[model samples]
Target chain A: MTMGFEAGQDAFARAVTDPEAALPPGVTSRRGEADAMRFAVYRNNVTVGLIRALEMRFPVARRLVGEAFFRTLARDYMRHELPASPLLFEYGDSLPAFIEGHEVSESLPYLADVTRVEAAWTRAYHARDAHPLTIAELAAIRPEDLGATRLVAHPSAALVRSAHPAGSIWAAHQSETVTPPRAWQPETVLVARPDMEVTVRILPERDAPFAQALLAGEALDAAAAKALAADATFDFGSALVGLVSLGAFSARTDDEDLPK
Target chain B: MTRFDERETGLPRRSGLGLKPEHYQSINDGEPDVGFFEVHAENYMGAGGPPHRWLETIAAKYPLSLHGVALSIGAAGPLDKAHLARLRTLVERYRPASFSEHLAWSTHDTGFLNDLLPLPYTDETLQRVCDHVDETQQALGCRMLLENPSTYVLFEESTIDEIDFLTAISDRTGCGLLLDVNNVMVSAVNHRLDPYAYLDRFPVERVGEVHLAGYDEAQDGAGDRLLIDAHATEVKDDVFALYEHLLRRAGPLPTLVEWDNDVPAFDVLHAEARRVDGALAAEAARRNARAA
Candidate 1:
């Protein structure tokens, strides 16, 4: 008997996700044998395909965990999470959390954070493109208006904060040799695709407050104030020059600062 | 109305290869005489970046075809409008000579499975597939070619034959066909059917393009060989024979050699495409000699 579409899909989905599950009703292999062997092909395809998508997003994670170990972690995540959209690039939003909760990966506390930085890099790479604000544009802003200027960051800009030096760890993997620093240090990473090149740069913890504030739509005056509050040694001028050089902002509005 | 009727010209009757990102520089530098390049439409769905830039450079010289793997045309639910919109944008931007999707579904009510899951050949599915094709055509404002899936398992469901189902969909929706000879070979070997006989009954006239890919050989518990449409290796000699047979009957068509996994060097894929071109030329010569 022909199975209904919904029922057939339900069984097929279950069988693919779980190997022990029996083949869906009305399914058989050639030579009239059990469908288990053939069904495994689809199961393997789904598992392998999703794992590859995740691997593309988190190459550093793969390198950190090694090939076989990473596949095991990724397969566990795949069993629990299916891609909500056809966009494979956006499939690993939960990977950081998955790695964080994973007990086997608990020893590597910094792994999840590194994954978060990688995810941010991918999102930034695929994010919407826009002509970034030039240094000349910043210079053109009136001196008096500079503090009150509200900067608009490009869609391809992202800031990632982590307790461990995940950004450094990720960078180390990019080159031939990967050597962690002797001393452990927390890191804040800025990921952006300015001029169509994805760049990941590490920032001081003090810069997090300023970048976070600006990304949250705060005016420059309050953002700098918040940064200075978090860390007294924060150099506003150097930070501004660095950010502008990174092509961070897409537009800057000179709206008057509201009375505080 | 038929989109590929007398008023329209289909893809060039020559050989093409699936475009991979790694081969972008080599393809541009060497500028191979490939008739066209086919890419999965979803790969270029990014807003802007290297994908678009590379596609632009390639499109400037070669005809392109947007082959989609995520449309899920045989699913029970409504078509995903957002995905369809992205596809429309790509088609508009690239203006590929041919656009096609699999007859299988990769999506369900929950989320995309990301695999070309098989469907039972039944009247219910036929209606669902036809409706999906119509909806997709209406949304894209252009005709699409529906590919026959390479299925591993067979559904015991009672219904029409595979070729009839495909032809019915074509007849009702006025959609063209992307006859994947590798898929036919795989399914035929799996089902113990004659690959040649399967092609003998195929609707050659409705075929707008052709696909040739490699398969992995595996054995069942009974020790019988099974062919998996893995697209990982070079085209098998048997599959190539089937391709030659079909080309001799259908004349030269837009043929694509798909090597997605374990993608070989540019030279290797180019050699395969050239082999297909050689076959097409031979077919043309045979036809010309018969006419003379």
Candidate 2:
């Protein structure tokens, strides 16, 4: 009974992996001259369906590479990695890293960084949701012990600091929502669900340390120290004002009040 | 209260919409008319947050259904236990009305394809599918419904037809069918098989629910028509016509309109559900007169 089962799977892999292979006995494919043609349809549908799902998750990568080459890249990628789950949307978590080390993509070195930005952007969108502490809650924090206070950032807040100017590449993909970077420099991209919509903002060099420190769960004072070192001219007061406005912090808990 | 209980096997009302994370708010605000909601079970495999919160709120008022896309019952390999454990967790959270998966397989040892893949109808595959279904029914502890998939090609593999394979599984495990009308039409047209004939030959009595969706038609490299099940477009005209044919024959069962990508506003999906209601109502009226 299981003989046909194993035979069928082997036949399926061959039929999908290489379209030119002959169909198994008793297997009839209708599209081409023989069963091979018909099975080709299955191979095409599965391949195209998966590639399209990858394209949907990583549209910027697709746009950056253009249509034809991207399809080739996607096909090659599929050859190596098939889906382990049925949820199509969440399929390609490893493609960003894959592109980083892929030999064929040497020409587009920036592609991997750009893909990372996009991945972080998606992570922020689908991450666990948490309520940002309101202005009233912040007001409750006593100024006397503000430095020792630890703030929990919203779960969706993700910061990606890349050497490549990936922030600009990502921004350019948004059709009507264009914010052309004034200059191409290593930029820190902060992704957050400000309101209902997910927004990505390019961070200034001087202020990135603070955001990075805050992401590491550092207290406000320590994060500020790192921000100051990155740029002496860094304005802690102004940065905090902006970060708070973006719904970046979930809540601030006093150090002494921390659970044992 | 216990997070999830077995009583969740309760069915969503006659009119229910596909639950999407994007539409979490409107669902929470409570659309009493919406009755209940259903989700692709694989989406909520991870722990914590919105998927769980929203499911709890919606499940509280409206009945829920845990529809799945990745069970791969027809695969040559053994059933995936990790996948089943994730589903069991979801069952605890959502307490869905009906739990179901496709009568197809897309997973290989490497990973999942996400699409409901096609299977050859053969004696060997038949035994494999039944065994998988029996295991799944036992693991989940809820009666299951096996959904048919839309296919672009045919297999010349030896023996069995679509209905026969499904009936054999149904006979063995008492699993019901989730007949996707659009799939029938799409597969029938792609393979040049007759839609009416396929429908006429199916085991309608075993159909527990039905599905209606849209398709995009384009010419492949060789000029052969490829009907892609995009689900982004509105339900095709012919598909709706076929759906009416099904409701007339099967009576009023819980039906769904799946529009996954390029999703419009809440009103758009609501209007689509209302259209199904209109068709079902018309069919009942006609059936009543014939009885008279």
Candidate 3:
């Protein structure tokens, strides 16, 4: 009987993941060998191509673990988790979680967080294009309506909170000199692609909640309140300046229709 | 801007190279006399950035062919609407002269496998492929070329020959064929079929483009001459001979030298393109001689 589409694909998928698995029925090499090594080409292509994609998405993770170990980690992840989309950039959404649970990566406790920063950077790189809120746009807003106004974050803006100083760890890998922080400290990474270039910055502890709140679609007052709760000495003016400078906020003409 | 019409701006019957970012500066600086450049559509699907910037600059100077790798047109599952929508947006933005996808499916019910998985050549498959091609043509608002795949294994239940199956799709959906000569060589060698005869029987009249790439040659467990469609090395002598045979028959079709992995410097790809151009020139001279 002819192999159904789903049945054939299922067998192929199984065979690709597990090299020892018997070749699906009716598969033979050009020379008519029942168990052809020719099938390994597909297996290699499927696994290697994915591992390469994962490497591209998580370069810092790959660099930290080195090539051989990262390949092992990537292969392990691919065995169970196939990409839900054809977009390779969007693959490995759950890689940090996978790395966290992977035994090989256990020694590098901070590897997961470093991978999280990398993933966020990738997301920011591919996020939708939007014009960032300008300082002039913020200034034009009436003082009375400032508290009530809901600030929009750029689509490319992303925030990552990690127990280890993952932001600094990821940045150090980019340069020739690697400088670990003096101490292991929690870090909040702000990933934004302003002007179509992905830029990562370590956010202050107090500012993390403020940016997170805005990204969560909170109103200006509520976000500020959260920031104040996080740190008693929170400076709203400087934080607002930093956010605008990094192209975090999105400009809205909501106040345009308001009373003069 | 007026939409690009394929009939008016079809790719020239000359040699082109698969555009890589590494060669961008050289290509822009030299403005090499290559016929055109082709890129994987998925690579440029990201938001506006260097990729688009480079593509825009190169496209302005030369003809472009947007070759898609993840359309999954032959999948048994429903077409990925999101991918299709993204493709449409890209096509609209770029206005590529020719767009093409492979006959093999890379996606299934679970998700995309990222490899061009093989399919059986049966009446059911033929019909399904035709339907998908028709849908894709409608979605892109243009006729796309379906590329032949290089297979490592064959299904026992395959009822039709690969050529006939591909011909049937072209006939049914009015799509053209992207005859990857290396693929024909690889698949033929792997299956122990005559590559020349396969090329002779191929429906070249339906061809819209031609792809030439190198393959890795090794023996399988049974010591059979196995060819891997690895676009890593230079075009092999056998593959080049087949390309010559194809050019003699088809006469200077739009050919692309695809070297994806282990990509060499611009000089290498440029030299390959020049060689193909030399072949095309030779074919043209032969045609002129015959006319004389």
Candidate 4:
């Protein structure tokens, strides 16, 4: 194949950094801007393109950081990390984590949490289509097996725990700009696709502990025990009903591990 | 609303629309009445979605052409792998009748601009282009098409005329030409050269496909007219007139009606594709009658 792994990466770097500094045969380069200034236009255009794509993909995050700050951080992100593939929808999987670690964004401790919520929303929007268990289907499952029958979460189901009102922070930043004071209390987010439309909601602190255990693929008994221990008000009855209604699970199996 | 006549795509040497998402259902719901459907290969890079879904169904019905927008072939650097992988995937899936990209570069030290930016015509650049084309064809595992760009500015350092560069690229790389009639007219007028002069100089025999689309005649803030190939509005009369002129020489080829932004209804796009099919049909009949 003409395209090797190394050449493609190098070419992308050159194209992104200085578009015209190096030229291939038959390609004509723009002239007469005093060499240094010539590349400035292309450099600006490259940064602008990446920033705009990031803005489109993460509107809520951009709104949180405002235009100037977002552009600066987006520029840094693009320079350090190019997209692994052209599938832009899948681009920014690590952005939330990246933002949390950046020293410049350290003051805005909640910024990373807001970004995490936004990423979850994006994932839900393009998640694979699965047959959501109908209300009738759920009603058929006997209540006796409910405790033993593990519920499958929808492919888009994402439960995130944070120390900020990340859902409202992301939601409020949707249309207009605002810099509200971060809540001293922690918040949890539940992103799901109940219907064709994806929705994100804030979870009560009492329900937050269940997220890690479930997402970690722990057994049903262990997860419920963790959830119960974390919050006295963590009602298993309401949580089970909610999980089925939201199509949070793909399929269910008993907590008992089978022989390999 | 209909597939083009069977005879329109005879040799596949014609101008065609770069298929858009809006026209997918209308074009594929029936058969396309035009020569071919050329799409930005990058758009359909998705694993499975509207781009692939519609194109898959349509490619089986008509001759499809793959055009790469993010190749950044004209940049001083080498080809991009991820982009090429996607292109290779599209080519493997569609087995398209033709594949092509511009003499434009849109990548820099930063990342992708995702727009067709201009390149200067220099020997060093030409060698780079040939290498890229050769590499692209090898990666794609297919013969390629190279489209001339409708540039906004000229380089004082450019030694080769656009046509000569295209011809050289073809000779050395064994790639074909996707002659955009409107681009020829626009660039000739913008740079103060005769449009017909370009037609005469280009080796039309190597042209595997043709593209005819609308151009917005707007000047820069200084009022120096810039012919941007917007492809938004109707195919301009001058451009259509030029198409008629080019087709008379280049012979019948696959043509498309490209409208990316502010896409009108599906019927409007079908009508445009039908219009091209009608013209090509008339040309073919005229030749047949002459032979008779």
- DockQ for the candidates, in order: 0.67, 0.32, 0.56, 0.16
Error of 4 at B138 (Å): 1.5
Write one digit per residue (lDDT tens) for candidate 2, span A1-260. Answer: 22366666766665675556665444443453343344555677778788887787788888878888889888878877877666555567778788977875589887887877777666666676667656667667788777776778777788878777788878888775656557778888888874446778888778888988887789889999988887899998778767766777777765353333
Best by lDDT: 1
Native interface contact recovery, all models: 0.67, 0.44, 0.62, 0.10
Q: Is candidate 1 or candidate 4 better by lDDT?
A: 1
Ranking by TM-score, best first? Answer: 1, 3, 2, 4
Candidates by lDDT, descending order: 1, 3, 2, 4
Clash pairs, candidate 3, are: none
- Model 4 / residue B155 / CA error / Å: 3.0
lDDT of 2 by residue, B1-292 (tens): 1111323125542656787877888767756476457788876764444566667777787777788888889898998898887887777666677888898887876566555667778877888888888888777766788987787656666478787888888887878888888889888877778888888888888776778788978654456665767778778998998877777777777777888778888888888888887887787788899999
* TM-score winner between candidates 1 and 3: 1
> Which candidate number would show the highest TM-score if scored against the true structure?
1
Top DockQ prediction, candidate number? 1
Q: What is the lDDT of residue A73 in candidate 2?
A: 85
Instruction: Kindly give the stretch of ten consecutive residues in candidate 3 chain A with the minimal lDDT sum.
Output: A251-260
Better of 1 and 4 by DockQ: 1
Q: Which runs of model 4 end up more than 4 angstroms from their true locations?
A: A1-118, A121-207, A236-260, B1-36, B47-63, B217-223
True lDDT of residue B251, candidate 1: 90
Tell me the deviation in Å of residue B239 in model 3: 1.4
Interface RMSD of 2: 4.4
